[model samples]
Every structure is written in structure tokens, then in C-alpha cells.
Target: MTSAVLHSLGAARPYAGSRPLVLERIPVPAPRAGELLVKIERASLCHSDLSVVDGSRVRPLPMALGHEASGTVAAVGPGVPDVKDGDRVVMVFVPGCGDCRACDAGRPALCHRGAAANGSGDLLHGEAVLRTVDGERINHHLGVSAFSDYAVVARESAVVVDNDVPFDIAAMFGCAALTGIGAVLNSAKVSGGESVIVFGLGAVGLMAVMGAAQVAGTTVIAIDPLPEKQALAARCGARAAGAPADAEALVAEHAGDGVDVAIEAVGSARVMESCLGLLTRGGALVSVGLPHPDQVLSVQALQFAGMGKRLLGSYMGDANPARDIPAYLQMWRDGRLPVELLHTDTRPLAEINEGLDALADGRVVRRLFTLAP
Candidate 1:
């Protein structure tokens, strides 16, 4: 019976606004059927984690909350043939069952079983693998619980990556990179010469800028409430970056015809509505953010119909991990995606609360957490 001790930061009372995440020692169990034991190298802090922690999104309490992470396979369970020990990988929150209709149609992001498991806070088998030192059960958040030094995940949740990819950069692919570029390439299918505007200059929004840059002859504009983030957006190769009013003015300059595409990365319904106004006739608007239940996206029926505008709800950027991850990483390797532009530094895992605070306050675009080995 071999086992390892690992420390994790998780909120015992999320949304209660009490203590954030408790650093608790937990046992890393041997990988079971079709599972892998991953030694997490870098786990990035995402707004999704914040949503869960701040109670804006209801999740099982005492949950080891994290879905974005990069790690090396420490061990593989029976029936898992593709991934072996020492292989570098990125964790995907959505795992596609090959037999599912969604997977057969090449849209694994909508896999029914995977979504169910994530919603239930368990592995694919509908059980939790995490346990406290005293033997108390800990809920696995999104089948990852990557806030810990080690995590056991279903094999279907991992995408094996090249050895040369940095852990921090790979970690971003778990959500940020995939969702951002996926919105452009997959959901919007944005092509060359298409004018694009991105709202909310967070990691995902900035990545949308990078993705738009890959399209030839496309004019990319970025919008954000924060001036610092607007500047960051400019650095990411956006031709223009500023407030929502500025985006409106730019749209007006196009003769009241909006850009070819408008991407909404912020979950705010207000922001989502504002994006619709920035679209030209027949333009496509892609929303990748998770919206609050009470929040709604409303549009005037006649205006929407008259303009022939298209509204797309994109979850996880609608990217298939097996195919999209490598292609996005290739862009990262070619200096097109430019991982460094999104992540400027790393924070120790112990300082996770401060990182989350910075994120909540919009002090940082992306926070990379370096887990202790």
C-alpha cells in the first residue's frame, strides 16, 4: 500500500466569505482504473475558481477547487495505455467519452457524462478520490482538485503535451488558452480580413487578441474597464484598446456597422449586451464566459432579426482538447500565441489567497501558482 502526502488549498465554506482555502494534508492514493496520479507542477488561479470560492457559483464545500493545471504523470492505472509515468500533460475539466454522441460529432466539450461528473464534483465513476489526513472525504472540484500538489484524474481528462512546453504555460491551456483561441477559431471561425473586437482584457480576452492576430488582414480592437488591462491588451497586439465607449466610437467610425466579430469574455450580462452593439450587420458575437443564473442576455427582437446578427454561447471555447491543444500550443511555440504576454510571473501556492485577491481586484491578468514538489 504505497501512498504520498500532499497539501492542498481549498475553501471549507465557499461563498460563506469566511476563510478562503485551507491548506490541509491529504493522501495521494494510487491511480485506480483508468486514472492517473499527476504530480501537479503548476496550477493557475482562474476566475472560475474565484466564482466557486466567493460563492457566486455554488459548489460542494470543502472542495479542492481547481480545474486549470499542468503536471507529470506519476503513475497510471489499469486499462490506461496512452499515458505513462513521466509524461507531461495538461488537465481538461471536460472529459469526453469516445462513445458519446457529442464526442463522435467532435464536440467533446459538451460530453453529457463529463458535464454530469463535473457538476456532481466526482470522478467519472461518481466517487471522490480525495481524503483528508483524518479520513474525511473531500469533494473533487471538476474532477481535478488541482489545488493540491497531487491529483488523481480520469485518463480522459488529460491531454498529453510535448516535453518542451513549460508547466506554467501548459497550465494555462487547461482553460484560458483553450477557451480564448477556441472562441475565435472554433466558435466564430474567424478568418483573414475579419475585423475583431474583444471585451474584457483578462487572460482569455488577451488570448483572443493573440488568436485574432493570427488571422491575416484582420483589425483587432480590445476593450476593458481597466486602463492597465487596456494597455496589456495593446501589448498583446490589439490595434486599439480602451473603454466600452471607445469601442462604441470605433464601431461608429465603421459607419455604424460593427466589426466582423465581437467576443465577450466577461460573464456580466451588461458586458454581454454591450458586445452586441459592437457587431456589424450579420456579425458574429461569441460569449465564452459562464453567466450567473439570474443574469440574462437580452436583445431587441426586431433589431437582432433586422441586422441578421448571430449570437453564440461558447463553453470552454468549444475546442476539442485532443486536436485543439496541440494546435494552440504550436502557436505558443511560434511566438504567435505569446504565453509570456498573458502570464508575467509566478506566485507560490501558499500565497494563493493574495493571488486571488489580486485577481478579484483586477491587479493581475493571470496568476500562476507554483506548487511545491
Candidate 2:
């Protein structure tokens, strides 16, 4: 099997010149115990992947470069008897070890074991299944390197989906849909008749708009620098959408003093700081963005007590893939959530670097990478 492996980091863009990701035919080991060998059908380019390309978020180098994807289970490893070969599954970046303290508390996204493995670029069980032709080990990205033709993932990382769903649509449930929608439905817990604003109208941010709309009577506002993105946000579900310059005014108009909940999806410390200012006195700010580790966010210590506001960090939308993926699929089926509105374009696996350029340029919301079987 071949995979797009990142041998070096911090390549300057146009990416056409730097070419950080190298496509090479690598060897794939068979599924280990409690794992699955997935034949990836669709993968999506996310800002998280770009963070790695640009060296904003550091990780082990010479690693396979994708995580958000959907595929069919080619084979299921021993001890994962609940799943079977031929099952259609969406691969989650974090593979929860069911016995971990976080998993036991129903917060699988915070599973300590999973975090340790992902940080080391190994699968949940601490194994690297990919290697270069010269035998150099290629680290897995968050356990699901869906950029390759095939991926070996922990059984806990995959949530089975119905075969009827389109591969591209099913793929969305893995990351963008899961994190964005889950952030609204689970983390912030926005209710009907409340006002909500989302910062950064990228795939995750736009999905946040759609999630807020799903709640009846919610006044939704979207903020982005791009006018086209603002327009798309209106179509997605935002009652009002505009650039950052007009954000405070828009919030005052649509949400009165402030919004009940504000979601920061841009991963910008600056934008996150702005989200805090736009919230209502008792409102909460749910930050789902993955900023660089070294970047720091400053907030007045008195604000939490003075204004009764809460700042919460959300990872993977605090999603339990097993529970949320199916529910989200049903929401898509019922027509309440038009997730299809998020898809901007599609590219082949070979065009991944180019896709990253598009994502960074703000030319797309969600770009799918269709892979050959």
C-alpha cells in the first residue's frame, strides 16, 4: 500500500513549491488485535491537517497525514467480535480505550491512553503499521491515516454506519460534522430560543452554524473575514452573518446585549478573545479550535465572576462517536440538518497538497478526497 507521508515540516506555501507531503508506496501490516484494516473510500482535508503541514501543531515527522475519513472494514482483528468485515465505518481520530478513566466517565474524547498514543503517532495500542519501502517506520496521524489507500485503526476508533449513506457524506460524520455538531449539541448544549454566534466560518465553523439552526427558534450569527463564507453561512442556518468588523453590531441586533453561547472554531487566539466579548452576561464560550501549543490566550480573571461567563475547551466536540455518529446520520436523513450544504469541492488523493492550499486560502469549506478502492 502507498501513503502520503510527511518527511519534513514547515514547508512554505504555494505547497506546489515546498511539497511537504510525499506520496510513496509503503508496506502495511495486517490488523493487530483489537484493530481493523479499513479500505478508505473517502477522506477530507481539515485545518487540523494543515496545522501539521505549517508546523503550527507539532507532531512526529515522517508520518502519514490524514485522520478524517470513512471506509469499509476489510478485516477485523481478534477480540473485536462486535464488528465484522464488510461493515461500513467512519474512522475517528481518537480511539478511546474503553477502560481508561475518561472513557469510564463517558468522556472518551479525553481518554488518557488515546491521547498518549496519538501524541506518539502510534495507534491506540502503540503500534506503527506503516513503513517506507526502505523500512523507515511511518507514524500514524491520530490513529487513522486515511490519506492512504488502506488504514489500520483501533476497533474503538470506528463507528459502523449504514451502507446506504454516500461515502462522501458518511466521511463528514467522522470529524467536521462530529466536532462541529457535537460542540453545539453536547458541549455548549444550546437550547431553543437562545442566540448563538460562531467565529470562523470554515468547515467546522459552518457546521456549527447548521447545528445551531437545528435548535428551533435559535437566533444564529456567523462571523468570517470572507464575504462568500458569510453568504454560505446564511444558507447553512445563520440568521445573520458578517465579517469580524460587524460582528459586535450583528450580535447586538440579533441577540440583543449578547448571545447565549459563542463558539470559537477558527483556532485563532485573537478570534477567541473576540468571542468572549460578544457573549451575554451569563453566556458560555465553547472553544473547539486547535491552536498551536505555544500560543496563549489571555482573559481578565475577574470576567468569569464579574459577568458570570464560562470559558470551556472542547475536543472532538466532546463526542462519543458510537453514540453521536448514528444520531447525526439520522438528523441528516430527517432533513433537519442539511449537512450536504457544507461540501465545497472534491479532489483526488494525489492533489492533497493543492487541497491544503485551497483550505488555507479560504476558498473552500469542506473538501473531500475520493480514494480508489
Candidate 3:
């Protein structure tokens, strides 16, 4: 089958503000041993994609621009036992090396060499899979370049799911949904009756709100500058929604002392500080946003030392895709995690620029690219 791959031309920075995504037809990839050739059904636009396109995040030029996606197994390479042709799967951001120190320690999210291996555009054998129109080499982004019609991914990176879930929503589970839900359930381990404050009410934040709501006696406080996002947060069971300016007041009104857990989904240093400030004594502050390298946090050392505050950095929400993806799907089936309401809009792959514009304008919460089946 022929495939149409989205290539990042050196022409212009697509994500700097808004620019067209360059699409080019390329040969379908052949899966190697321990690899899966997935025919992508849908790919979701992530904030990280925006950052990469706009040049805020540095990456190899002429790279494919998607990390979150869902698809069906078109073919499987040798020695792959768990997946077969026609199986539905969600691609995971981190391709864990099962024998790595982090993986051995039960922290696959922190796999040491995984990021470098995936980000360097080199395949497992130190080669590049994507090629240009002239047969020149191109780079792959985040291992699973599902922006293309098909992806050649490591077997470990594809999380097989039940055929019941819609491909569009499953695509979201690949990243935003997984990260948010995992942050609450795995990273924070939020228990019933806990009060949680989530800063930023985008797709990730909204999912955090949903995860928090699933636990009995949990109170969800959502913070967002946009009113539409706040409304969505309320729909997802936020006890109250407020802007950063009203964070302290909202905390006081909802929780007598302060929140038990505070999450920073927005990547601004200011927002992180605000989230830290909202936490009660000995409360946990989880940082989920990917701030720029130069971004620095200015915190009062005395407050952290005296109050025993804990700061935790979350990557992919501390997710172990093999375990977490199915659990989230089960939650969706049980109606505990409302995946339907999280989808704010859908567009064709060709209309990705418009969809991204809607995201930037705050017109939608989670916009998906419905690829041709």
C-alpha cells in the first residue's frame, strides 16, 4: 500500500505560529524483527507537536511531526508474539528498553537511553527509515511518526487495545490522555477524599480532572484562563474552576487548609510556582508540563524546607503503556473516565493546520485528525 507521509521541510517553521504541514507520498514501511508496521487510523495533534513545528523545540529538519496516534497492525515482523495483523493499538511515546536500569526499577517512563535513541532519528540498527522524494534521508520524530499514513515502530511501543474503542479516542490515549490519567493514578496515587488542584485545563488537565473524579471523595479544582476550558473542566467534575489570580481564594473556598495534590499542566514557571504555592504542608507538587530548557523556577527555599513540600517531575505521566493503556480503556468502558467528552473537534489530516489554529485560539480542547482507513 502507498503511504502519504508528512515531512517537515526546511522551508519554514510550521509551528512557530501557524503554517501548513507539508505532505509527501512515500513507500510503505516494512517492519523488521520485533517491529510492527501500523497503518494509522488516526493521529492527534499535541502541544508538543506545535512546539516542534514552531521551532520552540529543536528537532532534525525534514522530520515527521506526530507522536500520539492509534492504528491497526498491517504486518508484524519476526518474533513478535503478542500482536497480529488487524489488531488495534495505541502508540506509546516512550519505547522502553525492558532491561534498562529505569525499567528494572519499575520506572519505564524514565528509561535513560530511550529518549536519545528515539529522538536521534536513528532506527534500532542505527539507520533512518524515512526517505525524501529524491531518496535522501529524513528524520523520524519520537519513534512513532504516525503523522504519516503508516509507521514502523518498535514492538514494545505499540500498546494493543480492544477493538471496541474508537480509533480517534484511542489515538488520544497514545499521549495526552495517557499522560494526564497516569499522572493522577500512578504518579500522584491520589486516594479517595483527597483534594487536588490542576493548573491548566487543556486536554491533559481535563483528563486529570476526570481521573481525580473517578476516586471516591476526591475534590477536583481546575485552573485555566479560558472560560471554555473551565466549562469543560466543570463538565468533567471539577469542584470549582478559577484563573491563576483567584487560585488562593478558590483553594480557601474549597479546601479549608489547602489541596493535597497540586499539578502543573501549564509549562510556565509562573504557573509552576503558583501550583506549588497552593499545596498544603507536606503536599505533593507534580510537574507535568514540558518547559523550555531555559525556563527556571524561583521558589522560596524556606517554605519547601520548613513545610516539607515535595516536587515531582512527571514524564509521560509515569506511564507504563503496556499496563496503563488497557486500564484506561477499562475505565472508559466503566464510564469512570469520560473519553467522549474530551474530544472537542475532529478534522481531516489535510486540515491539521486549521485544527492546530483552533487549539492555539482556545476554540477546542482536544482536536483529532481523522485519517483515511
Each prediction's TM-score against the native? Answer: 0.93, 0.98, 0.94
* Clash count for each candidate, listed in order shown: 2, 0, 4
* Native-referenced Cα lDDT, model 1: 0.82
Ranking of all predicted structures according to lDDT, beginning with the best and ending with the worst: 2, 1, 3
Q: Candidate 3: list runs displaced more than 4 Å.
A: 1-20, 124-126
Model 1 per-residue lDDT at 177: 83
TM-score of 2: 0.98
- lDDT of the candidates, in the order given: 0.82, 0.89, 0.81
lDDT of 2 by residue, 1-373 (tens): 7688898888998997778888888877789999999999989999989998899888998889999999999998888988998999999988899898999999999999999999899988757878877878899999999899899999988999999999889988899988999899889999999999999988898888999999999999999999999999998889999889999999989989999999999887888888889888989999999888887889776769999999988899999999999998998999977778888877888888888888889998889987673
Worst 10 residues of 3 by lDDT: 9-18
Total clashes, candidate 1? 2
**Candidate 3: tens digits of C-alpha lDDT, residues 1-373:** 3333334532342332435476677667688888889998888888887767655677776677788899999999998998999999999878887878999998887776677767787554345677765787767778888778888888878899989889977988888877898889889999999999999888888889998999999989999988878888898989999787788999999987889999889878888887777889988889998777689999997768899888988899999888888888888888887778878777777777766666766677778776674
> Candidate 3 versus the native: TM-score?
0.94
The candidate maximizing TM-score is: 2
Ranking by TM-score: 2, 3, 1
Question: How many clashing pairs in candidate 2?
Answer: 0
